[model samples]
Target: MNAVAVIEAAVPASPREEWLNRGKNLGAERRDVDWRLADWLSEGKAAGHLDQAGFDFLADNLGIGPAKLKLIHKAAAIPTHLRDTSLTVEHHAHVAELPVQEQIELLTEAKRQHWSDDDLRKQTITRKVETGRAAMLSQEEWDDLSRMQFLHVWNRASVAAREDIAELVSQSHMRCIDA
Candidate 1:
């Protein structure tokens, strides 16, 4: 018997069979079109065929905003080998903004922790904040700031006094950086 005939014969004439057949048909044509479009955009950008104006025009025509196009470009830049295909596009978009090492670290952590996109986004924000705060403090200042006494003082300080102290520390750090 022919393959199509055999397959049809195997599926008994029932509602379940009809639903299964419909699902199979739909699944057969499913494609990752968004990823493909992002890759195409990245290729065009890399080749100098697509600049900000071109990207904006194309995005406008497609009904997606410039921010979405930028996200797609970022997602496309991530090497295929490094991407977690099982993750959602939003997850990939979040990790794509991170540095390569941090991306790997977070992806690994996400898998280990079974984190949702929201969880990963929160972690990313925390990481950025911690890095920024660390950048603002010298090693000695960091050590001092971590002390219990300093914490107690900061906890007890008035709002105005806290602001003045922060301003002074920021100026001192700026001077250190300039020198």
Candidate 2:
């Protein structure tokens, strides 16, 4: 076939292919908006432009939940250069407390692999363990030692403290079940 014929015979991009690329572009835009909002939030709070009442008003006006606002606030710690436009705000939040170099490395790998937020979170935890910043309990250790550790703490508590802890543990158990 002639070059023109060969070119004409090639298939156009499929809808799925187009949508996948669009998703990446959309994610990048979303990341930029989130980063800008986070910066504004951090600056406003620090500059006395936003207090609790002001935050309440803003949250009400913007329809942003306290939890999401907290996450955005936490995300403000991440530097702009380390941000990957192809990742979500949550991805940045997960690595916000990490060192700048770690953030760059993690975000770069995440963008290249198209990792989900949960996948990124797991990877971050693993990185923390590797760097000795955190520890992970093995399944066997959790099964065998968790109850003993709880009992050890529980036994030394005052009656009032025990009651408080009981309430907290009850709430924690409910949260775990809901999760």
Candidate 3:
């Protein structure tokens, strides 16, 4: 046997080394596993297999930067059942802040529509606006108002539209206070 083969035979990979190898493989593939890796890392930490030092080691060795680490940590909030294998990590991250039911609904719709990350983001914003509007106005009042495209796309609204929204929100707040 060669010297490298003999050395490999003499020393086996430790648990941490094995875990790191698995993580590296998953990271390199870049599919269906952002959450999986996050879940494993978190489980390892919880099970006493990984401490802060170990986490730092993996982060350094695996090239997991702060942004990716944050995304992984956030994506972990999504339950395994809710995760779609076809979707990317960014897709899951977009809906991670939403409630579990909303998460499932949006993810289902996203998968059905083959939504990109931006599409999912716009949908999430629209959903939030609808929910917020529901809280601030009765169904009748909401229906009585003129339909404006700007209302559906707050992020792309013009300056005047923003002013109008601010005014409307303030008026709604005043009405609520008066009630």
- Could you say which candidate leads in lDDT? 2
Residue 92, candidate 3: C-alpha displacement in angstroms: 1.5
Predicted candidate 2 versus true structure: per-residue lDDT over 1-179, tens digit per residue: 65654455778889999999899888778777888889999999899988778777888888988757767777888777766666777888878768888888998899889898767766776686668876443453244345655777899989999998777768895465232
In candidate 2 the C-alpha lDDT for residue 161 amounts to 90
Candidate 2: regions farther than 4 A off: 1-27, 51-56, 135-179
**Candidate scoring better on lDDT of 1 and 3:** 3
What is the C-alpha local distance difference test score of each model? 0.71, 0.76, 0.71
The segments of candidate 1 whose C-alpha lies over 4 angstroms from its true place after superposition are 1-31, 111-116, 132-179
Writing each residue's lDDT as its tens digit, candidate 3 over 158-179 gives: 8897778778878896464332
10 residues in a row with least lDDT, candidate 1? 133-142
Error of 3 at 124 (Å): 1.8
Q: After the best TM-score superposition of candidate 1, give how far the Cα of residue 1 lies from its true spot, in angstroms.
A: 31
Candidate 1 lDDT over residue span 76-144, tens digit each: 877888877655445676667567898889888987898987677556655655667445443543454
What lDDT is reached at residue 25 by model 3? 73
Which candidate leads the pack in TM-score?
A: 2
| Ranking 1 against 3 by TM-score, winner | 1
